[model samples]
Target: MRFLYSVAWWLALPLVLGRLWWRGRKEPGYRQHMAERFGFYGVRATNMPLIWVHAVSVGETRAAEPLIDALLRAYPAHGILLTHMTATGRETGRALFGKYGARVVQSFLPYDTGWMVGRFLRHFAPRLCVLMETEVWPNVMAQCARHGVPVVLANARLSQRSLAKARRLSALMMEAARRLTCVAAQTEADAVRIRQLGAPDVQVTGSIKFDVTPPSQMIAQGAMLRARIGPRKVLLCASTREGEETLILDALGGIDLGNSMVVIVPRHPQRFDEVASMIESRGYTLQRRSALGDKVVAPAVQILLGDSMGEMFAYYEACDVAFIGGSLLPLGGQNLIEACAVGKPVLIGPHTFNFSTVSDDAIEAGAARRVNDAQAMIDGACKLLRDDSERMRMGQQALAFARQHRGATARTMALLGPLIR
Candidate 1:
């Protein structure tokens, strides 16, 4: 099976390179990082026992943060080597954990070719490796197995589409799955999927993201922002992507939110300038968060363009209502869990395949509302704004729902004990 998998990968290398090139044409950051990884730039390991972590992007890195903290607490002597596949992920890591530069090292993961994988492993020599979410690279896993490094899948998830693909290539996937020492899945369905792919010790350890508690500073920052906004209705569009912002602005215009403010936070910081241009072209008076300096909200601003990073939770606190982005278009939506965690009245669109289970649960618990289109989103936002009582009620429900979902981190930590030691 391993031989066949390697042979298949060799045969498909050209097609993979072509697809990456096509994607890189539109994503400058992707192109830049691909060059860095392939060129083996800045790839090194400190001389210490290391625990390697692989997270593809910002969301996965955030999801694995609590666990990373836990691991560091448990093994103070061990160092951490974090690898990301995208430039945004690398930037976020530096922003979030750069303070621990002495202990935690961040870099782009090498490509999945056997030579690159061997070089990466030979340098790091990690005691244990943790792969966050659903990033399963056959060559990487096989190399870890060869090196006798215990590999675990932490906070693992397998969407239906992924499961279907895995089933189609069960033999190859099974070989990779067998190389994993253990699988800690987000849901029972995910565990079942891993089992189908021949993971021997698959377990449903729940999602660590639910266990995250917002920092006090973030809470205080939110309070300060609310005081500055001073009774004006604030609609926060968090983690919005391309095309969604235009629709959201159109919806806001329809509602005619007199003096109310709309805050737009694009998912990637690199798109700040692009999003800012779009906001100006739409004829909305804009005040950038960076340019505002000490002022929470600019004095005569109609639109607040969030052009900074690491302050999403604080922004969530400042708003009365939040429209979770990516759902309006078809990007599988950003995590609505953060909004729910903050107990903000939340809204989402129809497309949420990436977080389907959580979205459905939030809607069923009366913690969130799902809008069908741009018009519906405007109507929903207006309705929520007008009815303060209903808004507060949903907010309370959301907080309670998030509180009830807290034990996943503890469960996942317990599952990791045997493997890490």
Candidate 2:
């Protein structure tokens, strides 16, 4: 099966490269660093021992921030090698870790083939491989095993749907799971699901995301943005996926918003213009965050399009109520923890299989409310907007819930200590 999978990858190589090139039309980052994807890199290997972390994209990359900081502090003698698959992830790494200079190096993880991964392992010669949340590539795991490198799946999670999918590739997945030195899970449910897939040493270490501190600068910026927007109630629709925007817009149309404003930040940056068009086509006056600058938002603007990147905390801080997107359509859901962390009332839609445990717990803890559909989402947001006492109550609960979940990074560090030594 592994051989067949490798063969399939070889066969699909051209289409994959072609797709990358095609996607580069919209996201030019895909075109840059073409050699790195094939395990070729310009970065020279240093004599210092390195800890390699693979965070595939934005959410994973963000989740990795606290862990990366911990790793840097715990293993001062060792440099950190941050690997990402997406250009955005690479860019994010630069933005987050550029200050570390040569101490932290960024690269694209080569395509998941034995040959490619082997080259990556040889080049980095990392002391350990730490994969952030659901990045279990069979070839990468196999290569690390062959190279005798310890592999830890950090901040790991396995939803039932994902487990079922992994079960379909059990032969390969089991092999990969068994190779993992340790699996640090977000919740017990995640540990159970991961253990079911044959990971030998699965441990619940809570969620590292809970440990992410909202930057003080971002909070101040949010305050400035909020001041600029005047006293109108702000409803933030954050990390909204492709199709959810339309449903949200249509739902907002029926609501008597009066002086309230809706801020929609899409999940992917490439869709900024696409979402901008959607807002205008609906006849809603829109203002892009990028265009706002130091100017106050005009009263005529009913919608604020959060097209900028790396400012989610600012969005969370600026809003009175937040509706986490992706849940509205069957796309799991974006992280609500960030919103909760900033002490904002959160509204989410029905589907949240990706973040099932956290979502359910948030609802139970009174940090969030689950709405049935887009209409209910808007209605819930409006209701919260109107009821200051209830809204403030939920916000306080959110802050408390966030505070209660701290120290995952410390626990995770404790688990990794022995492995690294």
Candidate 3:
């Protein structure tokens, strides 16, 4: 199966590059780092010990923030090699670790083939390797085992749907799972799923994202934004996926948002313009975040497009209610924790299997509410908007819930203590 997978990868190489090109039409960063994907890149600061971390995309990259900071503090003498598969992830990594400069290196992780994996391992000579979330590449794990490298899957999670899919490739995934030195799973459910897949060791360390701290700048920005928007109620549609925005807009059309403004923030940066186009095409008057820099929002603005990057915390702070996207479209819900962390009442769509446990717990804890679709979301948000006491009560509950979920970072560090040397 490994050999066949490698051959399939080779065959699909052109298609991979073609897909990048297709996406590059909207996001040019996709075309920037071509050679790095083929395991050909320079390594600086080779004099120090190296720790390699693989975070595939934006969500994983952000989730990895606490772990990376912990590693930096734990091994001050060691240099860190951060590997990413997406342009936004790479950009985020650089922004997050740019201060470290040579101490923190960012590169594209090669495809999962024996030679490519071998070259990547040989180039970095990482002492400890960590993979974020649920990214498991059979060939890469096998290579790590062959090289006697300790690999830890940190903050790991596997939804039931993913577990069923993993079972189809059971032969391959079972071997990969067994090779991991330890699986630091997010929850007991995920740990159970991972163990059933043949991971030799799995530990429930909670969720690292629960430890994420919103920056003070973002909070201040949010307050400033709230002032600009006047006394209008802000309903944040955060980290929305492709089809979810249309649904949210349709729901908005149905509701009477006399003094309420809907803020639509797409999950991917590439979809900003597309989302803006979608809003305009739907006959809604909107304003972009960038355009509102120094100007007060026009009273006619019905929708605010959060087209800027790295300001999610600000958006959360600026809004009275938050409706996390991705849930409405079966793409799994965006991280509701961020909104909750900022003490905002949250709403999620029904298709939240990707974050099932968290979403369910939030709903049960009175920190959040679940809706079936865009109309339901708008209805729920409007109900909360009309009742200040209910929104305020939910917001307080969300902040407390978020605070209670901390300490995962310390727990995960302890779980991987032996491998840190």
Using lDDT, give the best candidate's number.
2
Q: Give per-residue CA lDDT, model 2, range 104-182, as digits (tens).
A: 9888998888999899898989988999999999999889989999999999988999999999999999998999999
Cα lDDT, model 1, residue 7: 75
Query: How do these models rank on lDDT, best leading?
Result: 2, 3, 1
What is candidate 2's CA lDDT for residue 175?
A: 90
lDDT winner between candidates 1 and 2: 2
TM-score of 3: 0.98
- Please list the residue runs of candidate 3 whose C-alpha ends up more than 4 Å from where it truly belongs after superposition: none
Instruction: Measure candidate 2: CA RMSD.
Output: 0.9
Choose the strongest candidate by TM-score.
2
| TM-score versus the correct structure, for each prediction | 0.90, 0.99, 0.98
Local accuracy of candidate 3 as per-residue lDDT tens digits, 50-125: 8889999988988888888888888888888899999999988887788887888888899898898998888888
Candidate 2 clash pair list: none
Clashing pairs in 3: none
| CA lDDT scores, all candidates in order | 0.82, 0.93, 0.89
Off by over 4 Å in 2: none
